[model samples]
Target: MKNFTRVLLAALLVASFAATAQDEESPALSISGSVDAYYRVNLNGTNDERTGGTIAPGTSFANKTGFALGMANLIVGLDGEKTGFVADLAFGPRGTDAVFGSTTASSSIVNQLYAYWNVSDAVTLTVGNFNTFLGYEVISPTANFNYSTSYMFSYGPFSHSGLKADMAFGDFSVMLGVFNPTDLTDFNPTGRYLGGVQLGYGGVYLNFLFDDDFFQADLTAGWDLGESFYLGVNATTASDSFYGGALYLQNSFSDDFSLGLRGEYFSDQGVGAITFEENVIDLTLSANYSIGNLTIIPEIRTDIYSADEVIEDADGIDVSGDPINPTYGSNLSSFTIAAVYAF
Candidate 1:
């Protein structure tokens, strides 16, 4: 049934685009998507039970023939001399969250909708749904070197529905926007109305987003050392009604055929009921030899959580700390092997 719906929608979108196309001879309409297939073997047994910053059922690593429509995005893009429009839609298994209280999965909807109007050669105005410009991590799995989204990315605001403006100055570009503060929250709470700013140049980036009760700022930088090797780092600080001011850092090392390492640490400054004043560390390293269109990527990653105190209920079980044992599995780890494509 779901597969049938997806096919139907795809056809409908194409049909609408064709019917509305004025020139019929212009080559401005482009439709594209990708296929990501993989096998992920989680060492934590099938019933290990999840207790951290994730949307899986248990703590165990998950292994399967994975395919998700949400991971694949479709965009109806129309480009002209100075104006462009895009209506983005998504569908598939790897959707952001499962229905609350039920393990059943959720599908997709219109994730991004916006238009770009260039006022001058160095500036443009955009109004609609787009990715936030703060974190080094992104929600799209294929856009990332790894399949898992970072705690920082998942923890921070995902997307905002609003209007924005952008400007280019020599080697850098600056973006600022206002959003309705509402987001696609797994069909739960209505988001907060907020705004943010992003500036980027030469692989270095910085962003700031704020609302009635939350304020966050992050910085990122990346470097390529030639010889198939690269390194990147991200740092963030924020304070919210639920959690106090906190600091974090994440880093990555990548090479052609050998290894990659990732690590992140977070500390609290006094805010939420629990404060989430815990430290988490994670790592992933992989190796592969590529030939033409395919390459095999086998990787391993872990999560470690720690705190001075672990709160508990009357039963002597950790009821106050995060669901994932921030302090154990080397503290926590998952492994995978996947083949991705680029064109």
Candidate 2:
């Protein structure tokens, strides 16, 4: 009888342990990503690089002529009740251009890798490399309505590696972070660091980033005008660098079709050249057609500069032996068609 009682007690203890384990929520793992490709053509310049310069705009992505691969992104995530981690990886030309500051081969493919802890219902802390919160556009093609990036986004910081805290209060939210200098995503070799702050209410965000040598202030907002029409606005000014404003107007015709227009006015403050001061205006129109997880974008873009000779023309050289490749008028135009698939 004593032996049977001991055996019964051991079984009961095991059962209780199993029941507790079943009641606790298990960590969930998820995988998702996107792939993109595009074809582009110059409207006023040579399509090839035989003239010693590419005819695309000065923006970040979708600049290559003919057919090109954008990137393949893979994001893996694991979430628990109070902790989570994300590993985002990318490959191809667009990804390489985006993560240009990553020095090592292993770090080059990593777009974002971070771990977060939920300190409370309204507060969270995250550490590691993550995308900057100041921009209206992101590095991911699937997220932006336009295939090509804006000059403000191209000049702003891409990613930051640091510690940040996000807190929320009703409709208001605040984020504060200390990071390595702009685009230094792997580690901080320079002793200087960057600080950032973002304040949000409703859908509008006011962001600021500052360091010893750089300071930028940005405003981003979005609104829905009707059942099918939406508008987005972004404006930024970086000290001694660049200042620009862009407006995004989009109308959805159906569940699978939408049209978007972006208009921008940008000014360069001799960032590219010692004596160059130019103001530029860009207008882009695009159509989005969605089928399941795939989206097709057809776009047309035109840029006008304040000064002549801003863009390279098809003409090769002048009679004075000076290169006329970049000696055309103040305007440049191009067309692009892109396909993006997400899952």
Candidate 3:
């Protein structure tokens, strides 16, 4: 009888410990990412790059002619109750273009690597390299409604390595950050730092970034007009350099199908601007069709420039087989079809 009682008590103690272990929250590790590819063609211009022909728009991604690979993104994350970390990586042409500012070989493959601490219910702090908060369109295709990027996004900062603090109060939020010089993700070599601040009310955000010699201000907002229709707006100006605005309208016809349009006006404040020497207007129409975790996007885009800046035709050889120059035009049009899968 004594031995039986002792055995039963020991078993109960062990069961209690097991239950306690199960009740405690343990950190979870997860994996998620996306892969994308596309086919593009110039409607009115030559598609061959061998002849020094510009394949597509001057945007960042999905610019390659014919069938081409976009990228494969792999993200790993560990989430805890009060802390978390994310490591994002990318491969292929689109990825390479996005991280062109990386100075080190090891950091070239990294898209975003950051850790966050939830100091309170309304405050959080993050450190390390992360995507820029100023742009409406992100570096990932899965997050953007259009596969082809915009001029504003192409010229804006892509990523920053820094520390940021986010705080929320009711319907208002604020973010402040200090980072290494724009896009210098590996290390700070210039010894100069960038300061950033963002204020948000409801769904509207006003952002500003400045350094010793550069400054940029931006506004981004979105609204749902109806159950099936949405509107998004973005405007940005860089001091003495460039300014642009874009409008996005989207309508969802069903759970699996939707259409969107983007219209933009971008201007270069000439003398020292990084873009073209003139102004440009871009219009893009795209449709999204989703099948499980895969989304297909077909897009039509046209770019109209204030001057004849687009390469319309380029033939390296003339009739007599001598080298000749390319022809320029005021407008360029293109079409693209892309497929993206997320997991």
Q: Is candidate 1 or candidate 2 better by TM-score?
A: 2
Candidate 2 lDDT tens digits, 1-343:
2343234335433433343332225588899999999999989866656564677777898989999999999999987777778999999999998899999999999999987776679987778899999979999999999999888888878999877778899999998777778889999897666777899999999999886677899999999999999999999999968888999999999999999999999888866621223787889999999999999999999988787666666566567655554546678899999999999
Model 2 regions lying over 4 Å from their true place: 1-26, 273-277, 315-327
Off by over 4 Å in 1: 1-27, 44-70, 96-107, 182-192, 241-258, 268-277, 287-295, 307-330
Query: lDDT by residue for model 1 over 1-343, one digit each (tens)?
Result: 2343234335434433443333323337867544445665445422223343232212111223233232445667887656677776555444333111122243235555676666668877666666667766665544565555455655555565565667799879887665554354223244344656788898788887766666787887777766566677877777752221212222334433545555655543443312323555545555453445445557676654564333211212265643433332224345677665433
Q: Which structure is stronger by TM-score: 1 or 3?
A: 3
Give the per-residue Cα lDDT of candidate 3 at 134.
Answer: 94
Clashes in model 2: which pairs? none
Worst 10 residues of 1 by lDDT: 54-63
Alpha-carbon runs more than 4 Å astray in model 3 = 1-26, 270-276, 314-328
Best by lDDT: 2
Q: For model 2, what is the C-alpha lDDT against the true structure?
A: 0.84
Candidate 3 residue-wise lDDT, 1-343, digit = tens: 2343234335433433343232225588899999999999988676765565455777788988899999999999988767778999999998898899898888999999987776678977777899999978999999999889888888888999877778899999998777788899988897777777899999999998886678899999999999999999999998757789999999999999999999999887842333444688889999999999999999999988787655456656667654366666778899999999999
Clashes of each: 23, 0, 0
Task: Name the better of 1 and 3 by lDDT.
Answer: 3
